[model samples]
Each structure stands twice: as structure tokens, then as C-alpha cells.
Target chain A: MHTDVVHNEQSMTPHPAGSARHPQAGGRSPRRMTPARRREHLINTALRLYSQQSLEDVSIDDIVTTADVSRALFYRYFTNIRDVHVAALSTVVDELIGRLTLPPDGDFRQQLHHTLAEFVTFVETYATSYTALLRSGSTIATSTTDTLVDRVRDHVVDLFRERLGHSSSSPMLERTLRGWIAVVETTLLSWLQHTDLPREQLETWLTDQLLAMITTTAQHDPTAAEQIRHLLAESGDEP
Target chain B: MHTDVVHNEQSMTPHPAGSARHPQAGGRSPRRMTPARRREHLINTALRLYSQQSLEDVSIDDIVTTADVSRALFYRYFTNIRDVHVAALSTVVDELIGRLTLPPDGDFRQQLHHTLAEFVTFVETYATSYTALLRSGSTIATSTTDTLVDRVRDHVVDLFRERLGHSSSSPMLERTLRGWIAVVETTLLSWLQHTDLPREQLETWLTDQLLAMITTTAQHDPTAAEQIRHLLAESGDEP
Candidate 1:
């Protein structure tokens, strides 16, 4: 998730003559964007459109027109529409990682409650883009470094590690986290389509789901499960 | 896994024209197909192309050309290319359900080992089509009755219910099965892309993972878990 497709697009942007930022030209009615800024502009433009529409339904022309940039300018930064989506998707992944981190406050369940709510909000905000990413067989290419999904998996793992006061996690633990996160992702996607369920109930449902999986994973991998069981026991000790 | 979409497609075939049992036409060269057989022919044609290429890469022109049908005739059944893909996808789902039925075996673990091996074979046979369906937000439309994914979920849930000697399972049991199945589905999709792992090892890994999830879910919902625990104890008694 913390990777380079976006940077690649930035590198690809043609350094057009007038697009360079100039202090002297800044006083003009319309300011020229620096090449880097133009690339960011295009990514943001693409992301905004993607947040509301399906990838199949979205057009390159729709993106460029909304950005008020010519096709030539759009082509300078992205060779294909998928490039723009890839860039936007990486950005969403970054935002997701940031929001998912939890405070060392409440008990394990409390922390989960807090984190799941934030997770749900992020999905709601980027439902369109998130849907688009999930629709791709590889949200971010598997060949590409660790996946954006892996990034989310890491966030959940870090919380478990932190809660358990463990320096490292087992492969079984990692697989459990990966599987649990996939469930959360799939369930959230299903929930997005069916919003009839109230928000609190949905949050409770997600929290229960995560807790249930952790409780289950523990039975198979007792060492890791023991750590979590101890953590829950200790969380009760805190207050 | 016991479901209706595939059966529904089979039933929808019109018993029209000479396509109906043409015992006499059997000797005729290039004999006319009944409406049901013609639909089946087109679906088979589409499935063949889908097996080799991504859905977007396959064209309506490609389907008709492969089937040797004109554009007008193609419209006689399918509304568009997606329609053909959906029909073909349902057929694949039926094949999957048929292959996944469990046999009375050594133990629960032994039965799962047998089922997982068959499941992997089905995916290996239909890798391209499976990939295409997973790329869709829902493998089968969530709105359109029970999905192919849901069908798999039912298979797991039914096994659990039967093994436990329960007439019905809890809500949590159902959710756990749904989530575990999603994990299995996600893992299989990933495993398909990275085939370095040996098939037997992959099957063992998947079986273990499913067992782990069930164990964990049981810990949380002890009513269902107790039933499984007792079943395992009795399986020991059997031998």
C-alpha cells in the first residue's frame, strides 16, 4: 500500500513549458501548475469521479473534462484510465491505514469498536473507489510489493500485537488476521449495498465478527490465542 | 452449495422447434438444435472463450464467431455479453456444487480433505472463469437470489449442522461459516494466482484453515461448539 505507482505517474508527467510554477507568473489570473502538482491534480480529479461511479461506467473523457485539462495533458500523466485508478487506489489505502490505527485506551473490545467505526466511515467516504478496487481481482497487483489489502491486514495485526505486548506474530496469527480482514472487507461491501441495518447495529455486528474470529483462531493456535486471552484478561486489570 | 440458479437456467430453456429430441435427426448432418440445446451450445461457446481470457477481453463478436451464430441469432437468447457470462457463470457454479458434495469418510477432517481436493480441481479447471466471477463485486449478484459464494456457505453450514446433530444453527454459526467461506474463497483466489504451492499442500492448508475457523467460532458460540466437540469425541468412539 505504501508504494510507487503514484510516484511512477509523477515521473511520467511531461514537463510542459507553461505548466511550471513561476513566482513572476503567480500574479496572473490563473496560475500554472507545476508538473508534480498537475499529476496530483489529475489523481485527485480521477479519485473524485471514482468515488461516485463504477470503473466500467467511468470514462477517461469524463475525468479530463472534470479536471478541465486537455486529453494531451491527461495522457502526459497517465497512459491508461487504470493508471489513474491505481494512483487513486493507493491514496485510499494510505488513508485507510492512517484511520485504522487505534489508541491504547479501552479494552480489546472497546478498541475494536472504535476502530471498526472508523473503518466503516472510510468505506462510506470512498464507497465508489473502494468498490472499484475490490472489483479488481487484485486490488493492487499481487506482483506489486505487499498488497493494499496486506496493508489493512497489517493494521489489524499491529493492533493485536500491541494488545498482546508481543514482539512478533506467528504465521497462523497472520493468516487468521488476513482471513478475518477479508471477512470484514466482504461484509462491509455487502453492508454498503444494504444500508437498511442501523449504523450502531452494523458496528456491533462487525465488532462481534472480529472478536469471534480471534476467539476461534486462538483455539487452533493456542500460543497466539493464549497471548490474546491474556491480553483480554489484563485489559480487565487496567481499570 | 445446493442451490437454484443453474437449475433455473436449465428449466428456462424453451422446448421449441426441432431442437427437442431429434432421434430421427440424429443421423442428419448439422442437424437443427432445439431451443434448449441451442442455448446450451451458446453458453458452452462463451464458457470456452472465458476460460482463456478476462471477461473484458472477451467480445460479443468473439462469442458469435466461436459459436458460428449471426448477431441476430445471438440476440435471440442473451441480451448482451454479460448475459452470456452470467449464464456460463451459473453453469460453473452448478459444476462446483456437484463436485463439492462430501462423502462419508474417516472423520470430519478426512472428509474436508477429500472435499478441498475436489474444490481445488474445480477451480483449476475453471481458473479463468473463477477469476472473472471473483472480480465482480459479488461472485453471483447479491440481489439475484442465493449466490455461488452463498451456495458454498450453505454446504459448510449444512455439514456443521449435520455433524453436530443440530436441526438448526445459530446466527453466529451462519456468520462464522459465511466469513470462513469468504476466507476460503479469497485464499483460493490468491492460491490460484500463485501456484507454486503443491496441490496436496494447498488442500491441507485450506482444510486446516477451515477447521481452525470452525474451532474458533465454536469457542464463541458454545452451544454449536459443544455439539462439534461431542461429535469429535464420538468419531473417536466409532473407531
Candidate 2:
């Protein structure tokens, strides 16, 4: 499980221009851009490398070489590899949250289905980094990175609450929602590793898992049953 | 979220004999014990300290002083604090696995309830260290420690498989079980932080949560439906 792929750092030979490693390859030309644009470019370079491999495998040298910038410039923008990793992951979290909006006027099932689809697409897009960011005991694991992951989970829970139109959820309802969220995360992590089932099946199964949790919770807690009765009614799920 | 309660390391004063910190306290008298016994003593000392606070808060000095041993002796038995922490947690994992046995001749629901009761008891006994071990990105988090945590999860899954009498489970059944296991973990972690619900309710809700997952999976996968038919039937659950 601790198989961190270490790229060869002894070799100083840069990839040829236009190669896959250096997508925006240039022949050592003095291309000029504003400081903000340059910082974003560096972050983008780090993200592209993260896409190919775990954050533990990417290094400062890799980032600078791929960005076609000096080590000094890289340090000037970000203090270390972890700094850039956090910034890049924060960007990913922002993109994910921005893409997860429900229109608030559709059937509950359809809205949940669409939201889960978008979430799945985001996870697929950032598979490697998503795995690295969530995997416990990674060398690059930090409090900030963990907080970013929590932010995503909290966002999903808040979205669920908003859709249910409840000012405050009963304890049973909250725990049921949180428990379902954990199931989704663990299932997605496993799916990313094996992908034994089709993506649509995974999506639909996760949706069903949440509804199942809510239904089961309702059986035990009258408050939850009362609060989510309308939810079951709206979705035509007689539980 | 990263509030690691650091103890005052500068205070080298050891607790009085027979105090809580040193259950086997002695008044500076050289005690005789075998090498294996000595190592076990050190491990127990770490566990005692862990029960009082998170692993992050306990230090080498704390362990040595509490155990009534010199720093040199502490080093002789273990490499460092993390070495002792890992050994202590492995002891916990062993105890948890040993206690989670299900009688092979009882009703499935009763068996599950008994096993979950034992699990809840163990978690309550080792609340602080269990939380620390499962929390992501802790300062003391290591691949070895993380593997110990995984060992517990794998043991639980194996127990389920044995009880289900399946030589090999279908993909849907395995995934459903794993996802429910995650829910149990997350729900317990939250429950530990806030004891808002009764312990019996927690155990029963978790049992129902697994049944719910299995039932929902059955609706989508015929293989799972066929595999768990006897399980649901024996438990007198229509779904």
C-alpha cells in the first residue's frame, strides 16, 4: 500500500518540446506573463502531473521542469511541493462544488441522480489525485489536505439538507445522511481501484444506498420518519 | 480538527505510586521481570497513557516516566514513540478481533447484535486511541499504523463472509458489505465524539443499515438476491 512511485531525480534531461510531459512546451523561449497568470500556470502544471500519478510521486523538480520555469521562480510562488499540492487540490474542490448544483425544481430522485452523476464524473476526472488525497498515511497527507476532503463531504451533506427543505434535520436523519455519504466515498474509492461495475450502475446503486439508509432509519426513529415522509412521497418511494 | 492536546513535556515529575497513570507503580525500587514481561509492561504503559489522551499527546518521556523505567531502557525495548504506539494498537486490534466471534448456531440477527455489542464495548474501552488511529492525517500516522487499522476492517469483513457461509461472494454483495462497514466506522467515529444516541440503538441501527444495503443491492443484482435470500429469510426480514 505504501508503493510510492519515485521518479528518477538524477536525470536532468528535460523532455523535448511538445512532449506529453511538457504539454505547453517551448524551446527555452522567454515567454512573459503576469505574476497571477504565472502562478496559475504553475498550479496547472502540478495538477497535470497529479493527473498522471499520485501527489507523493510528483516533486518540485518535476513541477519546475514541466512548467519550463526556474526552481527559484517556483519557490517564489510556492514554498514547497505540499504548498502547491494543497493549492491545486483546493482548486479541484472548488470546481467540484461549483459543478454540483441542483435546480431545486425537479423530482427528488432525478435531482439526486444528476448530482451523483456530476460527482462521479469529477471523481473520474481526478482519479489519481482523488485517491492520493483521500488515502490515509500518504507521505503528502496534511491537515489542510484532510480539511479539503472534509469540505467536499460537508458540501454534499449541506446540499442534501437544502434539497430536503429542512431548516434542521433530526439526529437520525443527519446520521443516516452522513453514514450514506461515507458509503459513497468508500464505494467510489473501491470503484476507482477496480471498476468492476459500469459507471451508471455505480451511480444508481449509490443513490439507492442513500434512500435505503433513510428508509431504514425511518423504521427506527419516528422523528426521521415524519421529516422524510414528504421526501419519500416526492420521490414515489413508499418506505 | 487538528487539535492535538500536547502534554507538558518539561514537567519530568512522575505520578505517585498507585496513581492512575501507573497502575503498577513502584517507589523507585528495582523490580524483577523477564525481558518479554518488560516489553509487555512498556506496551501496557503506553496503552494506559493512550486511554487518557490521544496518541499524539503522549511522548517518550511520558511513557518512560510513567512506566518507572529509564529512557535508556525504553529505547532498548522500542525504537521510539511510534514503535510503542504501533505495538499498543496492534494489541488493541488483536483484542477486538478475538472478542468479535459469532456463534455459528444462532439466529443471524441475534448473532449480529451480540457481535456488535462486543465491538461497541471495545471501542468504548479504547475510545481515545481508536479515534486517533482512525482519524486521517494525524501527526503520528504511518503506513504501518494505517495497515493495523485496515487489519481491523478486513477482520470484520472476513467475519461477515464466514457467517454468510459464502466461499466467494458476488461483486455486488462484497461491495455492499464493504460499504456498510464504512458506514459503521464513520457512524461510530461520530458517535464517539458525540454520545447523542444510546449504544443499543447504535448497534441495532448499524445492523439494519447492513440489511438495508443488502436488500437494496438485491433489487439491482440478481446474484446478490440469490446469495442473501437465506440470510434475510433466517432473520425474518421480507426484504
Query: Judged by lDDT, which candidate is best?
Result: 2
> How accurate locally is residue A110 in candidate 1, as Cα lDDT from 0 to 100?
84
Superposed on the true chain A, the predicted chain A of model 2 yields a TM-score of: 0.86
The fraction of reference interface contacts (C-alpha pairs within 8 A across chains A and B) present in each candidate is 0.20, 0.79
lDDT of 1 by residue, A1-239 (tens): 22222222333321222335322222321125667777776766566666556644667898777766589878988998767766766766777787787766877778878988998878887776566556434333322323665667777888767766887775555565677788778777767776756777767666655555555555556675666776546434211
lDDT of 2 by residue, A77-163 (tens): 999888999988888788788888886677777788899999898888788888887878888778899899899888887887787
Candidate 2 chain B: worst-modelled 10 consecutive residues by lDDT: B7-16
Worst 10 residues of 1 chain A by lDDT: A22-31
Which digits, one per residue and each the tens of the lDDT, describe model 1 over residues B128-191? 6666566444333323323655666687678767765787876555565677677777777777
Q: Give interface RMSD, every candidate, in order.
A: 7.3, 1.0
Per-residue C-alpha lDDT of model 2 across residues B1-239, encoded as one tens digit per residue:
32333222222222222346443555441355557667777777787787777878999999888777789888988998889888888877877787788876777788888888888887887788878877888887778888987887888778877876887778888889888877888888999999999999889999988888899999999988888888888888767
How does model 2 fare in lDDT? 0.79
* Top candidate when judged by DockQ against the true structure: 2
Clashing pairs in 1: A216-B216, B1-B151, B19-B33, B19-B34
User: Candidate 1: global Cα-lDDT?
Assistant: 0.63
